[model samples]
Each structure stands twice: as structure tokens, then as C-alpha cells.
Target: MKSILITTTALVGFAATAGAQEVNVVSWGGAYEKSQVEAYNKPFTEETGITVNMIAADNPATPLKAQVEANNVTGDVFDIEVSDAIRMCDEGALVEIDPADLPAAPDGTAAADDFIDGALQDCAVANIFWGTVIAYDTTKFEGQAPSTAADFFDLETYPGKRGLPKNPKRTLYLALIADGASPDEIYDLLGSDEGVQRAFDKLDTIKSDVVWWEAGAQPPQLLADGEVTMATGYNGRFFDAMVGEGKPFEIIWDGQYMDMDMFVIPKDAPNPEAAMEYLKFATDTQRLADQAKYIAYGPARQSSASLVGMYQDGKTEMAPHMPTNPDHLETAVMDDPEFWADHDAELSERFNAWLASS
Candidate 1:
């Protein structure tokens, strides 16, 4: 009887161990992925003993949709853009994540109040506020650096091929900014046909001089390879090249396009419980704060701000490099998820047409 009782306890332990398992998370690759691995994934594993299998995607939303539609979901969680998260939530493609389930700030402040406005969603939780900005090879310019959006269009002044993304969502705003539209009025202007034409017209000036890039890693490489004098890309990627690799690159704060990245669980995730646990563990104030050490993107929680210090190098300050810095925000265009959610399809179609035309 004693031996039977011991055997029963060992079997129960094995079953519990099997239940406590891993989650597959799909996210954007490169420096952003490295930051998450160091800040969220590693620490979450250390604390909970649940392994996080990191999968890289150019954009997590693409595969997430594919998985949901096929009804064969592999990824347990996905780090996606605000527009995608909201769109998927509305379409019942993502699981609802209540804010009440989130961990609170260290000071005991409620999670709802600690996070920045729009950082929380019915089915998602924002991890960072990042930006797409103009980055230039410092060696290419002598005096009077490109300071504003108009400078990106002035090929004669800067005098080299410009690296622009092929997508409409990131390109249209800068076109309007260069055309003299204020950041506050970008979405309002882009809403009208005439306004879109105006943006494309502005882009037309640089079209001949443009060297289009699709990946986040390509812009820095474009500048490094002398393929482009200036390129627009994620600020954190630029930061990584500049600080980590000692690349001579500089970011132009003028007209930065800011957006949020959130974590969402699919409607039928492979490991729904583990995905939720990882989401809660990863987005807490400390974990969010820790991410800043690896990248320049700002943490979503207000409480995380006070705790953010130097980079992993242990000396370089992280604040001024952040997209959320006051200096960077002066002419920044904050992304409107609802606007993109509504116009993405139509504008994307039009953008493709415009791109292939001339």
C-alpha cells in the first residue's frame, strides 16, 4: 500500500509538469526581438518556468491572420501593431484580455491608470510606443543636416538615393509632412482623395531618386552600404546600429510617425493559459522598463518611465533616444489605429497602383 501511494504521487507530479508548459510567441525580428528576448521572454521563463519559443516574423499580424483563418493556430501569442490588434479584436479573431487581469505597478497603482492612454485594449496590451523616423549616414552629410520632412524630399541638397518603404501607411504621412501639412492634420488630410493625391504628388518628386526597402533591417544596411544617403525606418533599429555596432547614423526627429505594438492571444491559441500568463508577466511595469535597456523604444506604462536608465552598455542614456522624448514629439505624428483600420485596405490598393504606375 505504501509503494502504491508513492507511485500515485509521482504520477500526479508528472501530470502537473506536463500541464505547466511552453508558449509559442511570434513577433517582429531583429533588434526588437532581441529586446523582448532579454527583457520579457528570459525573465518570464525564469519566474514561471514556462519556456517561451520565440518565432520571428516580418510582421506578426500576417501569420496570425493566416493561422486563425486556417483554424490551425500554432502561435500562442503574437506581438502586433495597434491597428491589427484592434481590427482582429473587432472581428473576433483574438481572445479578449481584461485589464483587470494585468499586474499592477510596483507602487500598487492600478494597471489601468499606470499605462498610457490607448495602451490598453479589450483584447490586447501595449508593450511599447515606437516610431518610424528619418535616419541618415552621418558620413554622407557635411554641414546643414536634414532637419525636417522637407529635407527628405530635397535630393539635390542631400544628393543620394533615398530609402523609402514600399507601403502606404508609413509613406503617405511623410509625403504630407513634406508637402507642408502639420502632423496634427495628417490623418484628416489623408482621408480625402485630393489629400491623398497631394501626398503622392509630393512623393512623385523623390520617386526617381527613391530606392525602396521592405524590411526594417534594410534601411540601416542601405545607409551602411552607401545605397541610400537617408532612409526612414524604426527608431530602435537605427539606435541599435548606431550604438551597438558603432554605425555612424543619426535620426531626424522631425515628423516621426509613432505607433504602438501590443500582445494578443488568438481566439484558439495552442496554449491559451500559458499565453495569458506570458502576456501578464511580460507587460508589467518592470518588464516593460527592462526592454528599454535593449532598444530605444519607450515603454507603454507611465510607471516604467521613472525606472528607465542607461542602455546595456551601462553608460549611454536611453531617454533622448526614445521616440516618446519630448524633443522627438514636437512634430511627431501619432498613429490612429481606427483611421488605419478603416482606410488601410483602400489606401493600400491605391498605394500599390501608384507605386507600379511610374
Candidate 2:
């Protein structure tokens, strides 16, 4: 009887402590973070009375992996790309996320059936379907604006510095697109050595005029600063600059690289219960749709699509800007997490060697 009383009291005390602790969510900074804060964080705190701390990183997975390996995990939740989520989960670094634990759609659908294909994973729940699209300074092109992927490589016609992500996964597909590889053939082509060489040769054409950006925020800044006239960047960041800040930029939807951003909790997170609560609350249909108002990222839930409407400014319609729109999907390159999972390391190594040679 004495031991049972002590054990119950200790459990109660631990529960109270966990309730008081904040959930530190690490994610990509800039306008993307701002959108999550506005749509998910603020309301979550209001209802749960738990203070949610948001930390920004160029890629949240970097710090997440470092913290886990060092056994000093600071973040309770991390928003990462699907490829990283899969890689980390396979390494036993993330907590398994069971779909049964998630809230179902408002219309009485199960979460397993409600989420879009590939949005839910073994250890992560995807929140957004985002795109890596090209954005150009409208002022720079006074005539015959760049409308297609092929135009990105037509330096003779466009005649300006191109801003590309330093990473190979993002750049290689665009190179293939500009070189006339069909969207359906991207992954199969990338799997071959000859295809990789073809991509490298295509990249070599504009190697002199390329300005490489590592962070999601840099592409918009590079274009805004006049450092690069045409740049590839997140569609939402470009949306924020064009609509929110009124920057003179226009997005080229052709051959956009569509990818999803997922939310995962580390196995050894500082506050596991609260972290789970935040994950559940923030990924429901309503919250997913709410995110669309702040950024152009498409909601991962099919039910959320009907709920998405005007942008946060209250005047601008958001349908046309979403990368998941049928019109936009026609030429877009959908993400294949398995391909990147198998080839990310080798391609990255070759990409670095090629970069050095240039």
C-alpha cells in the first residue's frame, strides 16, 4: 500500500511537469515559419494553454540529427522534408506516428483515408505540399517573359544570372527538364549514369551565370537584391514576396518540383506528451486549411482543400497560386521519396565533385 501511494504521487508530479514544459518546434525560417506560427501555433496555445516555442533553421533535420546523436535533444518537434523524415525514421531517431492517433476529417472520415497519398508515414505526418518553382524579377524581363522550363536555360534569350539551390536533388531535375526530359521519365532517367551526365552537361551551360542559394529564404532575397535576375525558390516564399511585400517578382510554374513538408517528433524529445498533443492539434483538417491563408502551400488533407479560400490579406484568391492546383500539376514533377532515399548520398557526392571542377 505504501509503495503504490508513492508511485501514484510520482506519476502525478511528472504529468504536471510535462504539462508546464513548452514544445520547441524546429522548422525552416522566414515566411514559411511565419505561416505556421500564424495558422498552427497561436491557436494551439490558446486552446491547450501550453506555450509553444518556435525555432527556425535552414533545414531543421540537420540540428535534429545532431541533437539526437549527441543525446541532447532540444527540439520537441521538427518540420522536415519527407526524404529526411524517412531517413531519420529508418535510423530509429524518430518516434513512430500511428495514423489511428490522428484526428479524422470533419465529415466522419478516418485519418488514414483522409490524408493525401504519401502524406502520412511511419514516423511523420506531412503538413504541406510545397513546390520548388522559378521566380524571376518582372522588371528584369521587359519582353517575352520566361514561361517554360526550357527558357530557364536559354541564357541567350533571358540573359541574366540564374539563382539555383546548391543541393543536387533540386537542381538536377530542373536541368533534366530544361534538357527536354519528360516529367514522367524524371526518376527513371535520374537513376541512370548517362542521364546524370546529361543533367551535368546541361548545368554546365549556365555554370558561369549561376548563383547558388542554400536556404529557402535566400532565393527571394537574391532576386530582391538584384543579385540574380531569375532564381528558383519555394513557391510560398515567392508568393509572400510578390503578394505580401509587393516585390516585383513573378513565378514560373512550369516544371515545378513538388514536395511535402512533414512534422516528426524525436524518440527522446524533452516533452513527449505535449509534443504529441501539438502534432495532433496542428495537423487536423481545419489547421491545415488555415495554413493556406498565410502561405501558398497546399494542405495535405483532401478535406482541407474545400476549406481553403482567400489569402490572409482577405482580398487575394489563393486557388491560382497553389502548386497542387490541376493547372499547375500538368507539368509539375512530383516528389519520389524512395528515389531520393536510395540516391541522395551518391548524387550529392558527384554534385560536389562537379561543383569543385567548375
Candidate 3:
């Protein structure tokens, strides 16, 4: 009888601790993080009493990879790009997620069927669809504003410092677009040495005037500080700076690279159960749609589209600002996760070497 009482007491204590557990989530910072905090994290904490701790990353994939490799996983959940999610899953770094465990849509459709095609994988569940596009300071361009991808590389025409990310995945595509490679031909051309050489050559044209940025927040800061007249950055970040902060910025949607952001749990997450619980709660139709209130990125779920309306400011319509808006899709570049999953290593090495030279 004494042993049974002690065992019951221990079980009750464990339940109390579990109810108060915290899950660490790593995601891209700036407006994106703020959106998640408002839309997902706070509500989740209120409902479950599980505290959600956010950690920002330039790209969450970088730190996720490091943590998995070192066998020291600290974060419970990570928001990463589709390509990175695939790569990490293949490497056995992520925990497999079953679609059946996810919440069903309001119409009673199963999660696997309700989610958009390619939104769900064995190891990740997509939350949002975002893009990288060129944004320029409106105050700097008095006469004519830059509109197309070609204009981004036309140094003499819109002469001033240009801001670009310090990574190949984002930079190379823009270079190819400016070099006249159609969206359909970008991957094919990038498949060859000469094609890559062409991209590098194009980038070299404005190398001296480039201001490289690593984090999403840096581009808007660069433009605001007058360090660069224009920059290539996440469209959502630019939207936040323009609408939320009232920065004089205009996004050029031509040749924007669209990608999905997904949530993945590392293999040895500190709080695996809470991570899974948070992942499902955060990616639901309502939560995904609510995110649009704080940022311009589109929700990955089809049902979530109708729910997305105005921004937090209440008056500004968010449809025109979204990366997936019909008007912005004309020359959009869909991210090829399979290609990047296959060739990222080789291309990254070559890109790093090129960055070192001249």
C-alpha cells in the first residue's frame, strides 16, 4: 500500500512537469518571427500552458544541421525550407511525422488530402509559402523606379549599392534571371559548368557595388540606413518594412523565387512530444491563415486562403502584398527542392570558392 501511494505521487508530479514543459522553436527572424509569435506561439501557450520559446536564425536550416551533426539538439522544432527539410530527412537528422496525426480541416478532410501538393513530406509539414524578391528604396529613385529583374543588375541605370544575400541559393537565381535565362531554363543551365560560369560572370558585373547580407532583417536595415539603394530579400520582410514599419520600399516581383517553409523535429529533440504537439497546432488551417495578419507570406493550406484577409493595421489589404498573389506569379520561379537536394553541396563549394576570388 505504501509503495502504491508513492508511485501514484511520482506519476502526478511527472504529469504536472509535463504540462508546464517548454518547446524551443528555431525560425527565420525579423517580421516572420513576430508573426509566428502572434499567430501561433501565444495561442498555443494559452491553450496548452506549454511555453513556446523562439530562437531566430538567418535560415533555421543552418543551426539545425549543426545541432544534428554535433548530436546536441537543443531546439524542439525548426522552421526550415523544403529543400533543407528534404536533405535533413534523407540524412536521418529529422524525426518522421505522420500525416494522420495532424489536425483535420474544418470540412473534415484528412490533413494529407487537405494540404497542398508537396506541402507534406515524411519528415516535415509545410506552414507557409514565401518568396525572395528585389526591393528598392522609393525615396532614392526619384524619376523612374526599377520594375523588372533585369533592372536589378543594370548598375549604370539605377546606380547605387545593391544588397544581396551572402549565399548561393538566393544569389545565383537572381543572376541567372538578369542574364536572360527564363524561369524554365534556370535549373537546366545551372546543371552545367558553363551555365554556372555565366551566372558568376553576370554577378561579377556589379560585384564592387554589392553589399552582402546574411540575415533577412539586414536588407531593410541596409536600405533604411542608405547603405544600399536596393536589395534582394524575402518578400515578407520587405512587406513588413514597407507596411508595418512605414519604410519607403517597393518590391519588384519579377523573377521572385518562391519556396515553402516547413516545420521539422530533430531526431533527438529535447521535448519531442511537445514539439510534435506544437508542430500540429501551429500548422493548422486557422493558425496558418492568422499568420498572414502579421506578415505577407501565404499559408500553405488551401482552406486557409479564404481566412486570410487584412493586416494587423486593419485597413491595408494583404492580398496584393502576398508573394503568391496572382499578379506576382507571372514570372515567379518555383523552388526546385529535388534539384537543390541533389546538387546543393557541389554548387555551394563552387560558390564559396568564387566568392573568395576577386
Candidate 4:
């Protein structure tokens, strides 16, 4: 029995030693980036003795593409938005993953199963889900706040300065939704001349009320500084400001457009095996739950839902923005990256033309 125990311990030590390897990663960097590195990546290195080489980028793919084009692909694992992931995969910039080798899905959760449909695909898997919702200063609204995308366009009823993303996809979808088109109808509508024109025409009606936000971080600051009474914003930022800072802002989840960020292994990554292990570890339920504490985006693992309480009580006032909350999830319309990847250029051309005209 003593010899068997000694053998088991020896094997475990050998496995641990073998797992230690150096890997390079390219990812979006900011306060959120630092949080992830500290919370997950650092611990991972300590456990396995793997050396992590992290490259920070405001936009990771541009650098990733440059590396791949140079045939010196250094990044083992990288992060990109869903639309970008699809584009990169189509361009042969990412590696195909075998899901079976991934870490066990959180108990009671099928691996990636809790992710919204189509969120996990051939070349990428959703790392986080976020939303753009109608955020308003509760004190200013007094009696009622805008409850839907249509209300966002109802300048008279919800009368306040507004903010919207400068990007075409989000603006167009919001316009279509406000125009009373269902999520299914949005693609076909945008695909047609009449539909595209209709959306622009709607935007033309409220152009003057809008402060077009150029960056993802801009909308929240606009709200905090009282630049706009009601604006569309990423739920994570808004929730952080409202909950952490005790702001009077409130977010309406109804009609929110759900967007996702994903993880993709860059082609010809130097340490592919280590990258795969890290990917599985990052997507595991506990790690995802820890990430959610600092970043408000919803975890991709379904089992992480129950772990949400680690941050705050599930019923807290900010609960509406929690991605796993049924009420919020039910009202969300998942953005289709394929449609965006294909049509974005044309849509942007028309949208810019219309904005210039307005």
C-alpha cells in the first residue's frame, strides 16, 4: 500500500511538471484586462508553472493579423468580438477546437450549452455575453423611464438628449426594433433597399437628439457627466457605475441587443496545447464566476449562474442587468454576427451617408 501511494504521488508530480510550459496571449487590455490576468491567468501559472506572456492591445486582432501575415504567429490564444471571430475564422486566422478535450463543463451545465444559441461555433466559443440597454438617470426621469428601444426613439414621450453607438449594426438593429420589426425581421429588412432606407429614415427623425458615441466607454461617461439624460450603453459599465458608485441610473433590459466576446486560438500558435488548456480553464464555471465579479458580463457557463451571488444578492436592484437573470435574458435579442460580418461594410457606407445628410 505504501509503495502504491508513493507511485501515485510520483505520477502526479510528473504530470504537474509536464504541464508547465510557456504560452503567449493577445487580449483586449484595460482595467478589465488587468482583473482577468490577476484573477485567472496568474493563478493558472502558479498552479501549473506555465509562464504567461501577455500582449496588451486596444484591439488585439490587428496585431494578431499582422503576426499571422508575417508567418510569425506568436499569440497562442486571443480574444475577439463574435463578429470579428467569424471574420477571422473565415480568413483562416484561427484554429479549430475539439470540444471534447475541454475541461468538464460546470456540474449541471453542458459545456457551452448555456450559451445563447449559435454563440459557440466552429472556430470560436463565447467567453462573455454583454448588452446595450436603455440607461437613464432615475432621479431625472422621476415617474417613468424608457422601457423599450421604441421608447428610446420616442423623443417626445421620453424627451431627453440621447446617445447611440456610431457603429451601423447596433444603430440599425435598434431602429428596426423601434420600427416594430421582430428580431427575425431585422436581417431581411436590412437586406433590402427599402428596409435599410426605412431604418435610416427613422434615425433621421431623431438624429438631432443623439450624441453619437465613438467608443464603448463613452456612453457611460456621458451619462455620469449628465451629457445625456437617457442613452444606450453596455450593461457592464452602466451596472458598475450605478451599483458601485450608487448612481441614480437604471437600465431597461427589455429589447436589449445581446453581444458576445469570444476566445479563439490564433493559427500557428507557438504553444497550442497550453493555450487549449488555458482556454478550458478560463471557460470553466468557477473561473467564469470570479470574472463576473469584476466584469459584469454574463458567464458563458450555465453552472456559473448559481455562483453569481458571490458578487451581490441575486435580487439586488442591479439584478435586471445580470445576463443570467431570466427576465433580462428573455427580453434580449441575440445579435447575429454572420449577418453583421457580411453586411457591415455596406451598411456602414449607407449609414455614414445618412448621418452626413442628417
Per-residue C-alpha lDDT of model 3 across residues 1-358, encoded as one tens digit per residue: 3433443354345446677799999998778999999999997776667889999988899899898888899999999999999988998899999998887777767789989899999999999999999999999887988999899998888989999998888889889999889998989988999989999999999999999999889999999999999999999989888998899999999999999999999998999988887898898888899999999999988888999999999999999988889999988889999999998999999988988988
lDDT of 2 by residue, 4-66 (tens): 344335435544666666789999989999899999998777666678899999999899989
lDDT (CA) per prediction: 0.91, 0.91, 0.89, 0.75
Clashing residue pairs in candidate 2, if any?
none
Q: What is the lDDT of candidate 3?
A: 0.89
Q: Which ten residues in a row are the worst by lDDT in model 2?
A: 2-11
Model 4 stretches with alpha carbons more than 4 Å out: 1-24, 29-31, 51-59, 66-74, 106-116, 312-320
Tens-digit per-residue lDDT, 1-358, candidate 4:
3433443354345438666578787776644575478657886776666777878775677788788889998888887788888888889889887655445543434565655566577788777778888788776675766788888888887777898988787788788888888876778898999998888888887999899886556777898888888888778877767776688888878678887778889878888877776776677667777777665788776666667644443445434457557788765678888888998888888888887883
Candidate 1 has an lDDT of 0.91
- lDDT (Cα, tens digit) per residue for candidate 1, span 130-186: 999999988998988888889999988988999999899999999999889999999
Q: Which stretches of candidate 1 lie over 4 Å from their true place?
A: 1-20
In candidate 4, where is summed lDDT lowest over 10 consecutive residues? 2-11
TM-score of each: 0.95, 0.95, 0.94, 0.84
For candidate 4, what is the TM-score? 0.84
* Better model by lDDT: candidate 1 vs candidate 3: 1
